[model samples]
Target: MAGYIKSPFNYTGGKYKLLDQIMPLFPERIDNFIDLFSGGCNVGINVDAHCKKFIDYNDKLIDLLNVFKNYDLNEILIEIEGTIAMYELSNTSTFGYEYYNSNSSGGLADYNREKYMNLRKYYNNIKDNYDKFHKNVILYILIIYGFNNQIRFNKKGEFNIPVGKRDFNNRIKNNLIQFINKIKSSNCEFINLNFREIEPDYYKNSFIYADPPYLITNASYNEQGGWDEDCEYELYDQLDILSSRGVKFALSNVIENKGAKNEILVKWIYSRNYNIHYIDKNYNNSNYQIKDRSKKTIEVLITNY
Candidate 1:
């Protein structure tokens, strides 16, 4: 229910509530704000007015920003609505892969239909997915714009997530226009870039919010074939590097054990840093059972000052 974007698909570690506490932790008077993971884009939109670069690795994510900023919002909806209804047919029918499973009752497959097909179609139409920029905004948008905002795929790169409790394609053009206008007025710049390629100078006295994938044995947020723990360690290494250069940073992650948790690596990673702060919070809508454990956590705010 954010102004423009729908608050980033209810992720496990999304910093929605913690923004108030996390904001004061951010270094004031920075020339710009940089969100490395930028999954739900809370960091970007929350501080969009002060950001110099709202970067992320997801193409569909950037597309949300781009289309909202550059394209006609009303026309985009008209284009999407015509294609969305094709998924409402019988589950066994020959509709596009974007439709519900008729049997996805409560499984994690929340991605079938909605805007993903349009995103792929849009990308394929543009003929630039192979380029260096790899503009795949439509693809990312489809993953989120779908029923559950679930991002999953088999070895063949086919999406197979189930349906959620509601439909997202029902939004009118006016909704998108207001959102687009909100983002357009902000001082925001979307970069389809990853952390490794960022220049060393970008970390100078800026806030780099790190919400990388957890270093765990199981993948949350319904994505299959999770990212490697080594990648997270590598990101932690980069976070430490940023801290050394006087960059202010805040990280949201699981710091306590809920029995089934295996974040020993995350603890090891955070222990290496200085000035870490712990904040208590809940993990609502999470598949984990938090009855025995406190849902609260230490929000690891890493900084030099």
Candidate 2:
């Protein structure tokens, strides 16, 4: 089998790194893969399902996936290239390389920052009146160049992230190409919907993989009044209902974090026949630090398969 597939978007809580630990737990074959909280889509995109339905509460993310699914890659790339040329951000450009590195005082860094801010302003302005096709491409560019490569909007629903410390590089272009090809060939459908809103009948004979926001930890998207304790309970109740109906599911969550324990999660898992698998939460690849040393964080994959 090939190695891990990369996600186009740098979604903060993406499951790309955890796929190795997660994919093997899935059933050998799937008729339809339903991703309940498909953040970056790394999981469902990699799963060997005949068809896929990716649902997320984040509408912007669903929009991005839809853009890739419906638009031409070359069309999007042309806009990207034009933006790159306009900003003089080619790989060979010294200004592009040093803009995010070393100096922050003056010269290339300042110039690149100015260009980025201008691009952001232009994107924000044209968001309403610009061509829809071009808007998708422009939104893609904003995400890649925005602060921390996140899809964060202000209370006013405007893309409000500041200029990031990086530019459009070869890796980004390659990731975009890979994403376009994968999404195009993967037979996937993107839907913007909350987890609870999905109907029970829609999940018959399908395998669901949910990677929801950790109750103990905080993320940008976890805010905006989403994913609370009640939401977690509702998710568990839904999963229990599914299990009763013979639907298979695998959900990832943090059982413990930073000296705090998710007692509710612990109780729920122990109260049922769900299988629990411990996942290595560490991203660092070092033998020097043993598993026992990192006791503060505990991640688990709870499944009803």
Candidate 3:
């Protein structure tokens, strides 16, 4: 409850700032807790020992999680050190994407494709079952070393972040086994899935947090990412379903829904009976400016079911 949990990845729209505010809202007693759209695992790290399930939807994100699964994590930390010993500036964000994806033993590429191409398909086929594990800690660390710690893929599902941006060696695992030991006590679980396939009945007595892609003009999930319209609608439907099922739900999204600017989000959420928490925050990846600041809307749906 009084320690910092760090993620080696540079996750976009991460909730590191809101962590303090979020902790107080967790259900007093939870059979399991889930960060459904967990990006960087920031929330998972903080919720550490308090929850059981740490299901995440991002394959690349969970690929990194697998490293923490012990076998892969220990090896990854070793490789990180080896690569750094061979070269300096391992944490610089100036590295190239091709360096890792091209030379990797098809580990990183395969893991990402599983979520990119067949995300919807896989989500429907199994819905909530998470079985496959990909050893992608090296890939994420490499990506974090390059391009401002950005993890992105082209429409073709390829990691396209440029290299030599930042050297990853800067953040070496000072004491790896101990680091993994910290979160391992939390019984952390990683899940690779699409939002549309999540069932409403699964949320009973669970604390759910969602940080979905912001609906904005030409926003490609990420500069190197993509989000289809059908999938978007499906995600919204899934959230609405989760709301009615009595799940403790909280979602971080931009106010822009339709017709209205950012204002539409507030009205849209209220119309559904969800309490809205408004806060002014700096939009990620933007130049620091007063005008660049945007209002982040956190919608909550609480029920006694």
Q: Using TM-score as the measure, which candidate wins?
A: 2
- Return the TM-score for each candidate structure: 0.68, 0.88, 0.68
Q: Estimate, for each residue in 102-165, the C-alpha lDDT of model 3 and write its tens digit.
A: 3223223432332222322322343223533322534544454444566766665455554533
Error of 3 at 88 (Å): 6.7
List clashing residue pairs in candidate 2. none
| Candidate number with the higher TM-score (1 or 2) | 2
lDDT of 2 by residue, 272-296 (tens): 9689999886644322135654446
**Which ten contiguous residues of candidate 1 have the minimum total lDDT?**
88-97
Model 1 bad stretches (over 4 Å): 1-8, 85-147, 169-178, 220-226, 260-273, 285-300
Off by over 4 Å in 2: 87-111, 127-129, 283-295
Candidate 1 lDDT, 1-305, residue by residue in tens: 33334343554466766676666676666667777777666656666436557676655556556755675656555444544444331222234234444343442234433334544455545644453223433343444454456655455445455444433432423444455566767777778887778876877756677777765424543255456655666766777777677676776565543344436545755476456566545554332344444332333555445
Candidate achieving the largest lDDT: 2
Worst 10 residues of 3 by lDDT: 296-305
Which candidate, 2 or 3, has the higher TM-score? 2
Predictions: Cα RMSD each = 6.5, 3.5, 9.1
Summing lDDT over every window of 10 consecutive residues in candidate 2, give the lowest-scoring window: 102-111
CA RMSD (A), model 1: 6.5
